[model samples]
Target chain A: MQWSTLIVFLLLFVLVTVLGFVAAHWRKADLNQLHEWGLGGRRFGTWVTWFLLGGDVYTAYTFIAVPALVFGAGALGFFAVPYTIIAYPIVFAVLPRLWYVAHKHNYVTGADFVRGRYDSPLLGLLVAITGILATMPYIALQLVGMEVVISALGFPMSGWAADLPLLTAFVILAAFTYTSGLRAPALIAIIKDSLVYITVIATVVIIPMQLGGFGKIFAAVPPAKVLLAAPVGQSLGMYSAFATLALGSALALFIYPHVLTGVLSAKNARTLTRNMAFLPAYTLVLGLLALLGFMALAAGVDKVPQYAPFFKQYANSFAVPALLMHSFPGWFVGVGFAAIVIGALVPAAIMSIAASNLWTRSIYRAYINPRCTEAQEASQAKLASLVVKFGALVFVLALPATYAIQFQLLGGIWIIQILPALVFGLYTRWFHRYALALGWLAGMTAGTAIAAHLKFAGSIYPLHVFGYAIPGYAALYSLILNIAVAAALTVLLRLLGVAGGQDQTTPGDYRAAVPDRDSGAGDGQMAAPPTL
Target chain B: MTTRQSSSGIHPRLWWRLLLLVPIIATLWVPWYNHLNPTFIGIPFLYWYLLMWVPLSAVCSAVVYFKTRDLV
Candidate 1:
């Protein structure tokens, strides 16, 4: 192990661990309440929400994988930039309504909203279970990211000894999350984002200058890697793939349990909307980070003797780490590596908290113990978060990293299946509850079948529409089928005179205004209704 | 609560909010900006063009947010 780098990394790791535990008292709330622990009492203002959401969305795995994808596959990997950019406008238009309604009802998970909206406890359970399934591998993938950085620090790579450090890191993570809940990640996200900004800025400036300039960097990349190949025929080959990936990912990004948890934790709808306006700042940084793949290619990191062993082990995933080790000093390498490892902890913490919220609110309370007290519910969530993190830890240690990635691919496909029931339900309750569930089943089945047909090798499926091949994201394709099924069945169910479930929310809930400053109506408390 | 405001329709005052869709449509139509020339600071046209939209999209959302602040 490199002593200086390991020392610096350990120092920062210890710092964040302390921050995580200390965050429980940061906001000074009763930790026994579910909302206080799971949603930070819904009290995060614009800046805190900005940092929290940024850290939550742009994950550590994303930091490693996006550039790795770009390094390997070229312009197609740049879809992340447009995906993040497109996400905000959609968030601006849709999520404030969700935020407003969630605040009014104290809904903690998307499934809670779905359950309340359709008056279907079964549907709520489905959403909750689907969320948990999708998130577990996602949490595991964060471990894979941490593994990359940890192993890059010259730790053990295999055997029981290798997993010891990961296990220790996670035990500490579980402890802080259990003690502090969402506050830990929200507090730690601030430092994570600051370090990320410094790392990205320093890398962009120093690396480009060292390698001659941006001109030389682009010149070093192969011609095919510089721009997307134009569609030769009616196929719309990579073009459609790029566009649909951007669109489908944007649509699915905010719907994830972790992202929605970030949204629901905001102080009010206005905070969410204002954040939508500014959150694209992360997208800008993400775009520049994607270009670093080209820089790594230019620098010939794979050819370097010192990093060749890592490149052989990790392939493209080692690009960023190798670049850092090759370029930065040992101490600054510690800071950058610490930034990435802390980045993993923030999202892993949030995802577990979100999954546990899904369990305690929608499944446990909704099914097992209807009369559980608020304190009991909060305790249940704390324990459930620990269980969720442990399950992910086992998933990473017992299985290959490829298995986590495959499951994560399926996770995206499965999570987006709920969009028809969740997102559409936000605007209107025209869909029959049973029909929505059926659509979810069809989408999940179809998405899984398509991915399996492709041997789970990729997310894009080539569709022959009237013999014209159009390859696009499997999520969007299945989502189309989902909407079609939901609409057709809704009409059929309406014709059969079947009852659509009652919506527990009202129109005013979607547009609830903040109370006047002196009114003593708290952050999530309903204001006096304005006359229509 | 009154049922006068229907869920299906956007209020006329909030029509400006549709401007938010501009970025979504523009970015998703990949063929529009999938070129290599007109490079900015040696970054390819496709790369810099999409990056430019990052900030521009924020401005679009910001405009929509300020416009609809009082309404919602």
Candidate 2:
């Protein structure tokens, strides 16, 4: 597939579709509104909120499943490089107090700051239906990392460039996310993190100097395929499933909902707390893309065709186009597959504008119309971000890219069961919004029946907990039994008093952030509270 | 809560005392107590984890730029 790496991957996909329709006139403003079509108008800074939160937490299934679980297990996929170096000191001690309580209460989703910090429109409709069912399989695993780089450029898989490249990359990612909402994926995540830090520090120094360095690629790999090996189910169950997948993915990386719509589209709160203390310099480029799974298990370079149930024969899903066709030159594998196809179009346009800002502010203005306006909630969040990019292009044409990589590690274990109703209703009002909606329907029905019995147990190939035995990383231990059954049914329905509602935010509205006192807008100013 | 601004320029504080050089270099490059005196500079003991994660990741990104450089 080399026509000069397909003319440098179609001239970097026509220079990222003319920088995604000139990022709707690069957030000049007045794009008819949902805070400038779902959050970019909050206006970013701190280096475009550090390349939009380092291209929304270094994705493309972390450049293909943490080097396919450290090339099929050894030193446990460097537990997502020490849980992204202890998730930037746990998002610099709790995300600038959740971006100073979602910019002093003008809260736009994290279920509008848990329905105004526990006043409760049914816990902001269960944190906007656990953020559109954990962000439609994390935007259908960014179209299964652009269908593993269009199934390693062979493409074919019968007709129309494999049944229309995810419906023409979701109709040019829903026409520049309906004309640059979230500034067309934060200005194409500064050319998708400068082509993923120039293709992960040029494939960890040109594939260990074309294989024979780093002690002859760790003496032709195999220490029964390292992630730190020696049958603790091959390296302590991949170092306790990448140290509980880097401390439950750095404490559910900014409690999802498109990373709180890229930390409330930053600009202030100290450029969202100095881009969460310089996002661990993109976890040192995701620990050099998890050491390109030991340079694709020491350059065997199969690039998939090895499945014996360590989630089917791994080469860490084409560990960066099999370490750019085993170390560059083939015209730098079209500038490393145009930096993994603009790292699967900057988290498929910020998970379809954080799932069309949860169907235009929690289901069309909570239950289809409480007199909808702001230009009809910015034209129903720009036609629900083109119907959430054609429902992630119908999960990239009806599933089976291994259930789109076990639906983004079970959408980070079902959106960390909406972290006790959005980070414990931003520091507690004492839960009970109908016992946090019956503890989010009993922790989303026991974390989807223990993640569908660890995805169809059948002699358990990649499943098992409470006797342990995991692989397709059982939705972070079924979200620790979905946050201990939503904090034990919110402390047994706040001690049987049968928790009533109507607190709609107080503790001085989490110390207000001044855009003319809680701009929920009904003109008269201070009238901002109410959700239920 | 405005008056807050903290990032004192070149910043770099203790940073969790660099987890005391990760168990003294993860017991000399994790093969868990390298099979009775293995190589170090000549490398083995799991190739001294690519020279111990580049100075424990530049001292954890310089202690997250010195505890959020006077966090604005």
Among the candidates, what TM-score does chain A have in each?
Answer: 0.94, 0.39
TM-score of each: 0.94, 0.36
Candidate 2 lDDT over B1-72, as tens digits, reads 222211122113424435434423442233352231254532354435543554564465456544444433
lDDT of 1 by residue, B1-72 (tens): 311224344545477788888888888888888887888888888899899998899999889887677656
Q: List the residue pairs that clash in candidate 1.
A: none
Q: For model 1, how does the per-residue alpha-carbon lDDT over A189-231 read when each residue is reduced to its tens digit?
A: 9989988999999999999999998889989999898877778
lDDT digits (tens) for residues A408-481 of candidate 2: 65666667767777767666766666665665666567657766665522111245557666553444555555
In model 1, how large is the Cα lDDT of residue A186? 92
Report the TM-score of chain B alone for all candidates: 0.81, 0.30
> lDDT (CA) for every model shown?
0.85, 0.64
Tell me the lDDT of model 1 at A497.
96
Model 1 stretches astray by more than 4 angstroms: A394-408, A513-532, B1-10
